[model samples]
Target: MNAMRLRALLLASLLALGAFAQAPARGGALPPPLPLFPLDNWWNADITHAPVDPNSAAFITYLGAGRGMHPDFGGDSGDPSAPIYGMPYVIVASSQPLVPVTFDYDDESDYAAPGRTPGYPIPNEAKSQQRWIEGGLAGGDADADGDRHMLIVDRDLRILYELYALHWTGSRWEAGSGAIFPLDSNARRPDGWTSADAAGLAILPGLIRYDEVYGPDPIRHAFRVTVRHTNGYVFPASHRAGNTSGALPMGARLRLKASVDLSRFPEPMRKIFQAMKTYGLLVADNGTDLYVTGTYDTRWDNDVLNPAFGAIKGSDFEVVQLGWQPSRSDNRRRSVRH
Candidate 1:
């Protein structure tokens, strides 16, 4: 072949390879940042008692916040600093086992509670709520104590969302019916604030919506939810907003540090983590009360050691870095982006 022809052919091959490398395999615009929070500072807080005003945008922000899981780093077993603040507020109202709830994404009915067996007449309440009694529903028998429910509301006291478990008596599946509960009353703040003072601050989702980005592949992403309840401490709400001027409402103004061991995840999730090549952080405006976000990244081949089960050499997972800055404006609920 002529020298010029050979050069042109080589260049074309290089360009094609670059395009292939940049294309996303199957997932959509990098899965919206997983709901990952911080591990230190504030760990848990309850906003169930906080009044939610349906008329205000804050109310919508609050509802959006309950959409994902808030993870944490170091504290007591249930509470951590990276996620939300308020320990008593972090209620898990699942009738199903935590293991199965977190691991078994395949069995849509695995999280359902055992219902009345054959021969026993369904209770009147169960019959009246036939939709909930059916199988394949998100709702189920809540924990016996009833402490698992957490309510998300706007500043106007409007109930935005409810997080709880459910039980199934009949044999059908649905998404809405379940055992719902509210957070303990002690975690909320006294109401009475204008929309302007709370501008830029909003509620963020707790669960990182992975299916939107990762597709059907099962990958476990670790995150932290930190809630800082300033009941006694007072700061200018306007000042908070001033500090975060010109940033995304749910962006991170502060950076935090965290680490995860891919080996901790089971089978497919573990394998998916191994295949990752890059990752990024995503945060949502849960409510004007707290900041929630998570990390989504490609796994480096070297960080794939299964230390929990046995030592296997892989990559040393990078220590996640984070930061937090006090906003200048009194807008106590400033949404920050990194």
Candidate 2:
């Protein structure tokens, strides 16, 4: 072949290879559309810094103590009328089993009340689980100030999560607006999968779904799980700014660490996770007051994931209508209506 022709052919081959590598993966048949939970208004009061108030009391009551029996034991509380504000509960990693750790604002006198039992027991099975290899306190205590913090340990006995329920005290925003905190540290697992890695992998995709300016938003809710990749390369632009409309960039790759176990999941979940080998992320944004997003790609039907993840129907996971902007006056009127 002529030199010019040979060079042209080589260039063309490289371009084709690049295009093929970048193309979106197509399975034999696309998996059935996953179910979603939708969010309500996106512009509520910035409760992140709001203070504890009557509303905060009610919110905590609903989440912590429950309506009657069968209370959701995950909240930290501060008052009796369910007034004032604090996390209803916090989970900390503990080496010892069965004894509940208390994190209250009132001193030891408060815990010494007549009928108040101070601690709870850890399950025997949980003690034998491999995740709690290095268990620690899963609860918290108040600091010099009255603000309360909560802690949680992952199955691996690692102190992987912490939550600071209400920190701002005696302020109007102090009731509902303390920081909902998370851990800043990272730990390495034997098979990869550090805590930070899991959180990043689980949360990033949902962040992408919410922030992406293009087409209809894919998420209905904000609660989600992100799986991390050990060998993947994040797109420079996507990392700095965000992803563009339609699809991801050409060289984007999400690599996973070795320790994730996907053995007993349903067929659909398995298929989705395997396919994620190519895409590396799966996001579900059910529309509601709560939002969930994550990094791991699993194929369970919407039925399974929603219940397991505390996602509600209709409001918990529904797609957001993009490009439908209301006028300022209209928004003001809508706010009044609410």
Candidate 3:
């Protein structure tokens, strides 16, 4: 072939390689940010106009109105081996092997359920990958008291598996409780059933993912939040983790008051606060008051994240009415996108 023809062929080959490199990973690699569940799902609901609970003031007081909003995720501490300050998740393909998971709360867990594939789609790497669980304990440290949450997404099957207090035995996997969620549907856990989260809610939907936080689009869903105390759970939250009178319940939604100004914050931080105004926060567990959960990512700068979130206090939020739902007409209007 002529030299000119050979050059053209080489360029074509390079172009093809570039396209392949840009393509998404084939073995269940994460796709670009999309709606986790349906748009009408509670997590994605537009609750800006939702009714404020009559007990909003009392609940906020119980949760310490003066307490600041805390970002419970970000860059590492000095120790490289210590688990990062956020929950971690993994994605797997449909062909990923499913393993039987023994659960302490077997009745509530979905193990061997009809719709679910016989076992959890937990990857083998979870046994060796330190980042698979909350505490960053890989195959060792089976007795840690931390929540040890393990969240796995089956990208091809559109399924979510979440395990609370997960531990790996030399021969098998065990957990305190396990829950499976269908990502494409908005189904709640059976009434009074606890999932991987205390609220019986899907943890992935409410978490602030790294990609979503730094992406071009705004975060369009509610965030998973924690409080020092909770009284029974309300609608959308399937289980009640506590009964502290006058305290907020699991599944309670807190909207950032519109009056809270974002002008002084940087653009990225502003998008986060803006999401609070729109989708609000859902109380999912018992922990420090006003702490929000996010995925583990080293790219996070806690120095910037900490102060920015700390500026807002619990008083800046209002609790929505218990079991609030958009009107039929409103749902129809907002149902256009996921």
RMSD of each: 20.4, 25.9, 4.5
Score candidate 1 by lDDT.
Answer: 0.25
lDDT digits (tens) for residues 145-259 of candidate 2: 3322222222223222322222212221111111111122221122211111222222221221212212232222222322111122121111111233332221122212123
lDDT for 81 (candidate 1): 18
lDDT by residue for model 3 (1-338), tens = 99999999999999999765533231222543367887778998889899999999988888888888999987568797877688777776667778999999999998853465579877677787677778777844655668999888777777888899887888889899998887778788888899999999999888777777777878888999999888998888999989988888899999999999999998889999999999999999999999999877778888889999999998999999988876666567664442
**lDDT of each residue in 248-308, candidate 1, tens digit only:** 2322211111233565665543443342212212232223222323222122121222232
- What is the lDDT of every predicted structure here? 0.25, 0.24, 0.83
Model 3 has a clash total of 0
Error of 3 at 250 (Å): 0.8
Best by TM-score: 3
Question: Which should have the higher TM-score, number 1 or number 2?
Answer: 1
- Ordered list by lDDT, greatest first: 3, 1, 2
Model 2: how far is 190 from its true place, Å?
A: 49
Q: Could you tell me the lDDT of residue 331 within candidate 3?
A: 62
